[model samples]
Target: MGRMDDRSVIVTGAGRGIGRAIAERLAAEGAAVAVTDVDEDTATGTAAEIGGKAVGIHADVTDPGSVRAMVQRAREEFGRIDGLVNNAGWDKIGPFVDSDPADWDRIIRINLYGVLHTSQAVVPVMIAQGGGTVVNIASDAARVGSSGEAVYSAAKGGVISFTKTLAREVARHGINANCVCPGPTDTPLFSSLFEGNDRLRDALVKAIPFRRLARPDDLAATVAFFASPDATYLTGQTVSVSGGLSMV
Candidate 1:
């Protein structure tokens, strides 16, 4: 039997990239997944592709009302929510000094506030049930700042800290919260960052001890581990899946 058999999970921003991979992995492991994304079509498409107890719902994590509705729908679909994966995020690369304040607001809203909205809406459900798991997808940039990603780093850093505190507060209620920090993974977002800069891409590859970027499946595997029974004793921790790029 799969480790996550009979479990139900709600994954935000699961329409594509790393989030999609996480949903696919968990569903493969026998978990019924609620794949929620701001893009309704992508969400439904992903759910259709996974084809197992997965259901796609339109959810905007930045809005508490949307998040609450998403959580409610998941419960209605699966009877109980066993896991929550906060993986929806966005970023624009550029000099911090040149960054627009408006961009900063948008970045913080989606990256930081999004997590808060989902956690607040879902944690109570986990409490009502016996236990559950929370996996927040942060970034290695949060641990060691990345150039041109100041605000994004700040937002992810907040996520890391929020997760730790949330973990402490919820542990007594049988809920485990953890954060996963991914290095420069080979996602569409990463590709967009170095579109015309092969030199920068090659430099990054050389800098990484592994000589390659991380795959979406790589991050997905770690998330699955955290969501499974194997991680029952772990809580309030941050695991970096950066292929040794950052050893802190």
Candidate 2:
């Protein structure tokens, strides 16, 4: 049996990237996982690869109703939720001065509001069950500003603050809420952010202390740690998995 054996967890944005890696990690640790994404096909595809222990649910973390439904579906499938990983987020880069309202809104809605939506939905269930763990996937940009990611950085920074508040407020009820901040990672989303420029990607690799970009699994491992019993006393904190890029 694994450290999280028999537990049930939900991982949002599992359709791709770090979210998909987190879902896979949790499942491997023997948790009944809810692999959720706005795209049904991709979510189900990941769940299938995680074996029969996972259930795929279509969810838009920015939507309260969809988030509620996701929580309901998790309980229905696994009987209860013992953990949660808020891995759903989106971003667009440009000078904040000229950034489109639509892009700014989208980033805030998904990266910040989604954390609130998903956390509020699952906290009650976790409370009812005595306690649970929550891992919010934040970004290094949130901790240290990025050149072209002003709004995105703000949203993720909000998440960091939200996590601390939520962690303290719910700690008495047996819930642990924390965040994992990752630096540049070699995921499809990372490539998408660079506009398919191969040289730019190489430049990014040289910027990190490790002389390499992080892997989705690298972030996933930290999320999994925060979600596990090993971190029972850990809460109201942000753990940076940025390959020594940001030390705090």
TM-score for candidate 1: 0.99
Model 2 TM-score? 0.98
Model 1 residue 140 distance off true place after TM-score fit, in angstroms: 0.5
In model 2, the runs with Cα more than 4 Å from the true position are: none
Q: After superposition, how far is residue 69 of candidate 2 from its true place, in Å?
A: 0.8
The sequence of per-residue lDDT tens digits that candidate 2 reaches over residues 1-248 is 89989899999999899999999988899889999999999999989988969989999999999999989989999899999999998888778898999898999999999999999999999999999999999999999888899999999999999999999899999999999999998888788889767897788788889999899999988998889999999999998998898887
lDDT of 1 by residue, 1-248 (tens): 79999999999999999999999999999999999999999999999999989999999988999999999999999999999999999999999999999999999999999999999999999999989999999999999999999999999999999999999999999999999999999999899989999999999989999999999999999999999989989999999999899999
- Residue 62 displacement (Å), model 2: 1.1
TM-score of each: 0.99, 0.98
